[model samples]
Target chain A: MSSGETLPAAQAGTVESMDCLVTIAASSGGRRIEISGSGAARFRSAMENKIIQVLDSLGGPGDLSVTVQDNGALDIVLGARVEAAYLRFREAMLR
Target chain B: MRRTMLYLPGNNPNMLLRGHLFGSDGLIFDLEDAVSRSEKDSSRILVREVLRHSGFDGREVTVRINGLDTEYWRDDLAAVVPCRIHGIRVPKVDTPQTIRDLDDALSALESRASVPIGATKVFCLLETALGVWNAYDIATASPRVTAIIPGGEDLAADLRTSRSKEGTELEWIRRMMIVAARAAGVDALDTVFPSVTDEEGLRREALFTKQLGFDGKSVIHPAQIPIIHEIYDPTEAEVEKARKIVAAAREAAARGLGAVSVDGRMVDLPVVRRAEFTLERAGAMTEGGAR
Candidate 1:
């Protein structure tokens, strides 16, 4: 099984806010990111920054686009969504 | 109020006539993209005549009109804007300016036909890449704009991505569009789940979108209506939980308490708001009972 095949339970305190819809779009070659919503703009930006940091650490040569619909979700939950999307994309590429 | 807005070709009388029984909350008499160029006039006349006589039992009736950039738009507005439809859906909206133009044209048509100024609201379809980028502006362009729906087929084409069964690629756009709608304080609708034969896929996607916080979904077939509603409607467990939360909150308030505890968890203002939304959803699903 590929590393991205598993659905990890959301970790406690992973998301700092629960008022945003987190969407991560990542391909095998590059990534594009967008944060949207009127409330919790700062949190969304911070989450996007962390996601980019993580993706840069992974050193995966692919395009990734992350869009956050901020509804005040916790930071951990936002991280989990980004990880889940990256894993899902990795799994699809493996397939 | 529309849970499932079914699209029917403007020229198809049989579909239009049987629309009420489809179990959709609204019917969109499609004259823009679904009908051919040559049949535009005839389709408008047919839809108008049908609207004049058809008794849809107060189902929200919407007419999708061609963009103002097209030659047929003026005639479409002149013909259908005066009809007793609930709203006019404009296709391929790229900017707030375009929507303003549509509003102007609608006003002219409404006045020319002696209709009320605000009788018909506008529903904007963000089809192209540029349209999606400007979805928020288009949604908030006018007070008459009630809903913003993404056209997945056109969007996919615009993005030059193949439509996948999982729809992962469209996820960002869908979420962004919903955020835009909510920011604008209007309804955000999901595009139709094609593949009428894949009912399971349809249900799964509907549930996913509902979880993503869309107000409703666009459906192509009658069979998809119930599935969409079922996904959208609050579950029994959720309703029960909502009832408990509301009851606890009410009791706490009566006792001069600022908060309530339910299931050993403290419930605050946000929790109450969620419970209220849950109850409202349950009420909408049921006829009169709290269940």
Candidate 2:
């Protein structure tokens, strides 16, 4: 609830086939996103765009870190996971 | 038309995306028992997205939400009711009051989502002995109720027994369910046959329930869909007789006669209705035909 304080991390989804696990945490620096796993090689840029779009839609803060470990989940699943993880992170911040 | 409604885990994208291809009459994207507690939130999100983006190939789509007792039920309704699903299958429904409460919640969500109030149907899963006992009341509790299903494992446990291959445990419950569902003018859907590997057992159980007048059975495996449908579908002989009976009844009505006979058997209003139902089940009649 105060500046200089770091909110705990929150995550959603799993590493199962056709799924992805997304984790969000507070960052002191500018926005940071990490993508890996099955989809990263071919869909890295698109996945990044998707995460940014979802975060912007939710009004996510600039000082946040988003990490996605994919398992061949489609774009819809990725967006959903990111939104869920971000919402959970925001909830944790509120607490 | 819901001869088989397949259950797809809400969080499993593989199943969620391809479940309809298995050819069940309907799909039940499950957010309750199939999903873990920790993944509840993410599963809800995933199911919502799937509903929004994926195509179910014209299969009747429904979602099985957590019971009303859980904190997730309301959120579940909020997520799926707006997606324009065919219904929600509610578990642990023990009383008419439970249906009333669920009806209210559904109405609220439907209104908020701009869906017509009462547009979403309710499929009641009678999982407790008390729920089975109150089946008639629960079925008649709301207009939104489309089907009342007697549970397998849960109901057997509630009755302090285990499931038997012969279904000795659920015989009385199945009989009672049929009576109550008919009395309440709702469909009685049988619970899943757990022994998926036992094709013979599945056929036997499907035949039994079909004979008892169940509208359909919940299917856990894709392999079980055709088996249940095979049991529920009207046979060639049955369809032919039903067609003849229906034609005779229609001719009798046209001739201003109050009595009719088919194949030397007296065909009354009930018999005519049954014939028409047979034709309907055979897909010989168009939707809403000759009711």
RMSD of each: 25.6, 3.0
TM-score of chain A, model number 1: 0.60
Compose the digit string of candidate 1's lDDT tens values, residues A1-95.
35576522111111223433445544344566676664445565677676687566656445655666654544434453455455545555565
The TM-score obtained for chain B by all candidates, in the order given, is 0.94, 0.96
What is candidate 2's CA lDDT for residue B117?
90
Worst 10 residues of 1 chain B by lDDT: B282-291
Which CAPRI level is candidate 2?
medium
Residue range B1-291, candidate 2, lDDT tens digits? 878999999989889999998888889999999999988998998999999998787788999999999999999999999999999999999999999999998998888889999999999999999999999999999999999999989889999999999999999999999999999998999999999899999999999999999989999999998888778888889999999999999999999998798879999999999988898888722442111
- Please report, in order, the local distance difference test score of every candidate based on alpha carbons: 0.76, 0.92
Give the lDDT of residue B24 in candidate 2.
Answer: 82
Q: What are the per-residue Cα lDDT tens digits for candidate 2 across A58-93? A: 999999999999999999999999999999999988
